[model samples]
Target: MSNTPQKPVIGISCGDLNGIGLELIIKTFSDSRLLELCTPVIFASNKVVNFYRKSITEINFNYQSTKEYNRLNNKQVNVFNCWEEEVAVNPGQLEDAAGKYAVLSLQTAVAALKQQQIDGLVTAPIHKKNIQSPDFNFPGHTPYLKSFFEAKDVVMMMCAGSFRVALVTEHVPVKDIAKYITKENIVSKLHIVHKSLQRDFGIDKPRIAVLGLNPHAGDEGLIGNEEETIIKPAIKEAKNSNMLVVGPFSADAFFARKHYDKFDAVLAMYHDQGLIPFKALASGDGVNYTAGLPVVRTSPDHGVAFDIAGKDKADASSFLTAIYECIDIIQQRADYDLNRSNPLKKINPEVFARMEDEDIRE
Candidate 1:
C-alpha cells in the first residue's frame, strides 16, 4: 500500500516455544545470506531463544528486543517480546505455557503486519490443539488469519521448488468435502490460484489442473456421480471465467510422468489429496503458503515434532524454504503491482454471485 522502496522486514512468528520453531528461526537468522535478503524480526522472547540455542552446537546470532521497528536499521535479528507471563519451557514437551506463547507471537506479528511494519510473515509450526486456549479458539493459522484480515475466498498452496499444489477444502474431513464442493468454492479457488500463479509466482498466463474426488474420476460417473454432478459444473464455471483450468482428472493419472509440469498448480479436493503427492515430491523441504491473504504468509509444511523437539535433529530445510518463499512472494507481489493491469476491470462479479450453499447432488 505504501510506495516505500525499502526491503521487506519479514515478521517471524515463533511457533511453539518448546517445538522446533525456535531452532529453525535461530538457524535461519544466523545465515548471512538470509539476513541480507530482508530484515528478520522475531515475535518471540529472547530468553526462550537463548535457552534453545544452548542445546545446539552451532548458534551464532545477535538477538535483541525492540519496540520500534524504525530504530532497528542495524543488521541484527530483532525480537519483539510478547510473552505475558514467563514460564520455563522444556524441549520435547507440550505445555500450556508454550501454547500460550505460540499464540502471543502470532498475535504480535499480525499486528505488526497490519501496521505496515512488516511486509510479510513467515510462521513456525504451532501445536493446534494446545494453542486453543480461552483467548484463541480458531483453527490453524490459515482460517485464523482469514478472520484476522477479514479476507474470504483464499486457498492453501504447498510449494517446494517447482511442485505447487493448492487445496480446495482445508481442515475439513474427507467425507464432508464431497458435501461442501460447489461451483462457487471451486471457481473462487481457481481465480485465486490463477492470479497467484501470474501475480505472485510471475507466470504471465498459468495452466492449472483440477483433481477429482473419486478414483478414475468416478469412471465417467459409473463409480460415482460426483465427478459429473458436482465437480464438472465447477470446472465449467472456472473455464468460462477465462481461468486456464482443466480436469476433474483422476488423481491417480494426474501425478504421472511430468504431469505437474503441464499445469502450474493442481487443486485437490482435500488435504491428503494434495499433500500426499506434494510431500512425496518435496519431502522435508515443503513450504505451506497461505494464498490470498492480505499480507504474505508462509510456513514450513511439517508439524511440531514433539518427539524430536529438543533432540537438535529437526531439519530446517522447510523453514528456510518458508522464509525464502515469503521473500519471493513479497517481491513478486511488489513487482506485480508495477506491471499488472487494472485489476478492477478483471474482478468477475459472476464468480462471487455463485452461492457457496448451492451444492449440486444429482
Candidate 2:
C-alpha cells in the first residue's frame, strides 16, 4: 500500500430523491474547485443522476462508476450505483419510494464510511417523516449516526465561519423538551462540544457558552427553575471536570449582542434556540455537523425543499460549504491524532525518569 496522503474521498448520499437532494449535489460538484479539495463519490445510481440532470436545465459534470474505492477517478466524480432498480422519479413529491431509496443510499455510504473507504460523508437533506422505516427509525441524521458509531452522545452543531451552536435536545417536540433537559444530558453534551472543538476544530482549550431554555434565562428562577436547577449545575460539573464551559445565559441576549463570537461554541437548550439564531447569523448558509461521531458527517443547514425541488431554485451554497467543512474536519482530526499519540517523542524516557528520580531524592 502506498503510504502517501492524498486528497480525501468524500462520500455523498442522495437524500429524499423527490426533494432537492440531487440538485444540490450536482450544483456543488459542478465547481471544479471542490474537486481539488477532495475526491467526490455519490452513492446513488446513474439513473438517479440522469433524472436530476434531465429535470434541471444546465449542469456539467461527468462521473465514473466504481464499486470499490481504488478505482475512483481523482479528476472526475464517481458514482457507486448502490441501487440498480428502475424506480420512477417524481420531483417535488413525497412518496414511499423516495424514502426507500434515500435510506438505501445512506446505508451504502455509511458502510463505506465504516470500512474507511471514504474520509467523510456529506448527506443532502432528507424529509424526516417520509424517511422513517424499520431500518431508519431515528429522528434525524445526528441520532442515526450516533447509533451507527455507537457514540454515547452526539451534538447537532451548526457552523458558519467562527460562529458555532450545538443543541442539547434535538428533534424533540416542545412539550417533551423540558423532560430531556436533565443535568446529566447537559453535562454530556457540553463535554462532547468541548472535545469536538479541541479535536475537530483544532482549539487547544475550548471555552463554551451554554444557553438557557426559558426566556431571560428563567429570570434567575423566577420564570423557570430549569436554568438554576438543571443548567447551572451542569455547567458547574463540566467546569469541575476541567472543561472551560460557562453560562446558563438567556438565549435572547446571548445572540442579540453577538456574544456567540466570544466563545468556541455555544450549547443551546433546544433545536430552535440554537438553530434560529445560527440561521439568522449565517443568512441560511451554514452546515450541520454531527459532533462526537467516530466518523465525520455533515449536511446543509436547510432541509429538503419539496416545494422547490424541480423548480431549480435550490441553493447549493450550503452543500458546498458542507463539503469544505468535511474536508477541513478530516484533516484536523488526523492532525489531532498525530499530536495526541505522543508529545515527548524527542525526549529520552531514561533521561526523563532520571530527572524525576533526582527531583524526588532532592
Candidate 3:
C-alpha cells in the first residue's frame, strides 16, 4: 500500500454572489498549482459560477458540477450545486436574493463539514447586513459557526504569518463591550487560544499577550479598572493553569512599539481593538480564522467588496492565504492527534533506560 497522504477535500462557501465572492474564488483557483495542494469543492450552482467567469476574461476556470461527494473529481474543481434555480447576477448591486443564495451556500457547505465530507472549509467574504435572515442572523461567521457547532465559545482570530490577534469580545457595541469583559470570559478565550496554538498552529509552548479594554490599560485603575480588576485576575487564573500568558498591555503602545513580535498571539478586548492593527500589519494578506471549533474554518479578512465586484479589481491574496491556512491547519491537527494518541506506546521508559545504560558503559 502507498504511504502517500491523500489530498484534503476543502469546502468553499460562496459568500454574497453579487459581491466579489465568485470573482475571488475563480481567480484564486484558476491557478492549477493550487489544485495540487488540495481538492476544492465550491458550494454553488454551475450557472452562478459561469456568470462571474464571463466577467473575468483573463483566466479560464474549468470545473465539474456534481451533487454527490462520492463521485467528486479530486483532480478538478467541483461545483457542488446548493440550488438549481437560475438566480439573477447583478455585480455591484445588493439584493435580498443575493443574501438568500449566500445563506444557501453557507448552510450547504457547513452541512458537508459536519458530515466530515470535507476536511476543512474556506469561506469567501460576506456582507454582514445583507446576509442576515430569520435562520441566519449573526454579526459574522464567527458567531454563526459557534452556534452551529455548539461550542461553548470561539475566538475570532486574525492571522498573518505568525502575527495573530484574537478578540475576547466580537461584534458587540462599544457601550456593551465593557460588560462582556469579565474575568471568566478572558480566561476562557485564553484557554481556547492556548489549545489552538498547540493543536492548530503546531506550537509547543505559545506565549500570549492580552490587551486592555480601557485607555493605557486603565492607567493602573485611574482611567478604568478593567485591567486591574477583570483582565489582571483572568491573566492570573490562566497562569495558574500553566499557560504562558501575560499582559494588560496598553493597546496603543503595544502595536506602536512592535511588541507583538515577542508573543505567539495577542488577545484584544473587542473587534476593532484587535482588527485595526491586524489589518494594518497584515498588509492585505490577512486571514480570519475561527479558533476553538470542532471543525477548522477560515476566511478572507476583508469583506464583500461591492465596489469592485464585476470590474475584476479584487485581489486574491488574502483568499488564497485563507485556503492555504485551512489546509495547513487540517494537517497540523492530524499530526497533533496522532502524536497524542496512545502516548504510552510512543515513549517506552525501559528502552530509554537501556539506551542510557549503554551510553554510560561506553
Best of the candidates, TM-score: 3
TM-score for each of the candidates: 0.91, 0.93, 0.94
lDDT of 1 at 138: 78
Most lDDT-accurate candidate? 3
| Candidate 1 Cα misplacement greater than 4 A, ranges | 1-6, 341-362
Worst 10 residues of 1 by lDDT: 353-362
Give per-residue CA lDDT, model 3, range 78-188, as digits (tens): 999999999998988888899889989998999999998998999987888888888888888888899999999899999999999999999898989999999999999
Task: State the RMSD for candidate 3.
Answer: 4.2
| lDDT of candidate 2 over 1-362, digit per residue (tens) | 11123588899999999999999998888777778888999989999898887776777767788887889998888999988889887888989999889988998999899988888999998888888887789877887888888898989999998899999899899999999999999999998899999999999999999998999999989998999999999999999999998898989999999898899899999989998889988987799999989888999999888889988899899999999899899888876775577554224767656766777423
lDDT of 2 at 47: 91
Clash counts for all predictions: 0, 0, 0
**Superposed Cα RMSD, model 2:** 4.8
Error of 2 at 357 (Å): 30
Per-model CA lDDT versus the true structure: 0.84, 0.88, 0.91
Q: Output the better candidate (2/3) by lDDT.
A: 3
- Clash-forming residue pairs, model 1: none
Local accuracy of candidate 1 as per-residue lDDT tens digits, 238-312: 888888888898897788665888778889988998898889888789999988876899999998888888887
Weakest 10 consecutive residues of candidate 2 by summed lDDT: 338-347
